[model samples]
Target chain A: MLEVKNLKKSFGDRVILDGVNLTVNDDEILCIVGPSGAGKTTLLRCITGLETPDSGTFLMNGQPFDPQGTKDSDRVIGVVFQDFNLFPNLSVMDNITLAPMMVLKETKKDAEKQAAQLLSELGLSTKGDLYPWQLSGGQKQRVAIARALAMKPKILCYDEPTSALDPNLRQEVAKIILNLKKSGMTQLVVTHDLDFAQEIADNLLKVKPID
Target chain B: MSLNYVFEILPSLFQGAWLTLQIFFWTLVVSIPLGIVVSLGLTSKIRPLQWILEVYVWLMRGTPLLLQLIFVFYGLPIIGIVFQRYDAALVAFILNYAAYFAEIFRGGFQSVSVGQFEAARVLRLSYWQTIRKIIIPQVVKIVIPSIGNEVINLVKDSSLVYVIGLGDLLRAGNVATSRDVTLVPLLLVALIYLILVGICTLVLRRVEKRYSYFK
Candidate 1:
């Protein structure tokens, strides 16, 4: 349901993505793999409208994903940053429900219910009352994933979803992704972990790092 | 010291102290929200707006507050924008202190992690909603001490009202001490200041205690 046609991006004189094209079919786990400095993260950012491409276009469900000149573009896409961008000030529940309540115009009660369900499904039910600082890195990332899911987004982008975790925790995260695949969720995961991609991804796009 | 003199000076000075308290309370009530607004202006995405707000804050902060007071209380009347001396003093105090409070607020706001802001943006909270709900709550917790400092300073600074003959606590003490060179009455006024500042410190400590769970 997402398309990036001939996307090119650069910072100063250095090019990150040069004429890269990719498409993600609905209900598929699309793994974007490359070595370090492959612009995989930048590619994810462009798709999510967090960064503008220097050229080409990104379309989500046949509509342009342009946040630069638009009033509200963030509602259409959901992202889980590698660093786990949770609000330290808010409880896990608040962090998850915030987007649904504020942007989606869902009632607080409804948003809380959905958030609780998502957290429970992600094996984070008990941690909902706690802040990000109280959770392990794996738990925090799971909460971030729950937050992305709470929005009921058409496309879910995960930037190196399991990179920060220990080997044991990475398996737990992979299981969660595999479950999402079974449930038919559209996911675009950027990672260097080849084994995890092989285990969960239905389609793999390998980006080449330029010299 | 005659009990009658103590009674005479105490009653009048008490009234003047009440006036001081009134000015102090109202200055906070008006200036704090104004300070936050000015802070947002300085941090706005638009460069020209940010520049203008920075200049405004700089002009307000760089000059002596006494000069600002004189400019508002004395200079404004020269331009036919007449206000009562008390009104002029209050206006000057609010504007002058708002700039300082704004700077403190901006510092508190910036101290929040950039990641928190990105999270808020991704959640699609409007600029105003994110500021009010996420950013400001954290900022309030952080800026409590600085706000307390400014408020206590505000109590003493209320004495500056005497310059325009507004009859605040210091002015009354000055008049009382001039009449009686023994200085007991002035000492009483100083005691009153101590009590007020003491109460402020106690209140702020309670506030700091409530939010101390964070760090």
Candidate 2:
């Protein structure tokens, strides 16, 4: 289980996340839904260590979690950015294998083997040698998910996973999220698509901007 | 225009070209890395260091390379910072080119988006790993044409060493021309410079091709 207590964040004088709290059970999907300017993405960013909360505490399995300690939090949390932030200079195979080899000290063969597995699982088996620019929107998103999964994070976060997809692709993403849940992956998704959230979220947290 | 005259001046011109090549090679060896470091400092968060480097770049870029060489060779002696003619030309050339390269690298660094850094952070990549694997490849792609421009300029700018009485290629040509009362040596010198720059262009094109794997 992961718990966030009394999270608060402000940029200059504008408060984004004000004293927010949430919880996610193991092997569950948690969706954060809010309109524009409601700080749903900000909350996810704070949880993923992309932004520092003014004051907050994160607990993983009842132990305190420190997102600022990169080494400790890196393996514990992963993010699939809105734009899919794949390394443009790298092919899909290399993008997925880079962190495993560089940070996890896995051999190139081992990392490539695991990346091939993930690509096959994500229906990207033949796309490994292709660059991100060549992939369609849905394919890129799946590659981003595969890239994050390669790290084997305890929890994965997504920022607007369905924002760029069409209706059919949105359903495709929902199915992928459901499949991840079946494999016992914890997830936090922030999006304004309430219907999509309701379709995949085991629980939903709604946020409103603090004036 | 005679082959005999060309051969007669060839040895002396070759000697001067050797010195010119030495200055060019050493200046690039030292200045390229120095420029990368200075560019990192420019983008760093330290305010005073950024200001200092900004002023340094401004000073170096604002002045002519010839004037800088003259200042290092002739003007610094009054302040007790005397250097040999060859050393003075090298010091001035390195400092001046480093400034231009710094600006070029700074632009390359800025072109990278903030998300690239954030992605590296979440992936547990150390600072150096991020720079080596992710950042550098992208920056190199973006900055190669700019770097090629500077490199070609450095080849031509090496002639500025002649102002310090160093017998560089242009100076040797000038000597032969004045002594023989003929323009042939100067023409040969121009041909030599064209050949050097042509080689650089071919090599740079190959480098650019290697990085063409991505857009």
Q: In candidate 2, residue A132 scores what lDDT?
A: 86
- The C-alpha stretches of model 2 lying farther than 4 A from their native spots are none
Off by over 4 Å in 1: A63-74, B1-7, B213-215
* Interface RMSD of the candidates, in order: 2.2, 1.0
Docking class of 2: medium
Which digits, one per residue and each the tens of the lDDT, describe model 2 over residues B39-156?
9899999999999999999999999989999999999998999999999999999999999989998999899988888888888888889888988899999999999999999999
Per residue, candidate 1 scores C-alpha lDDT tens digits across A25-126 of 998889999888999988987777667889987777787776443344435667888899787778899989887887778999999999989988988889
Score candidate 2 by lDDT.
0.92
Q: Score the docking of each candidate (DockQ).
A: 0.49, 0.77
Q: Against the unseen true structure, what C-alpha lDDT does each candidate score?
A: 0.85, 0.92
Please give me the DockQ of candidate 2 compared with the native complex: 0.77
Which candidate number would show the highest DockQ if scored against the true structure? Answer: 2
Give residue A123's lDDT in candidate 2 (0 to 100).
92
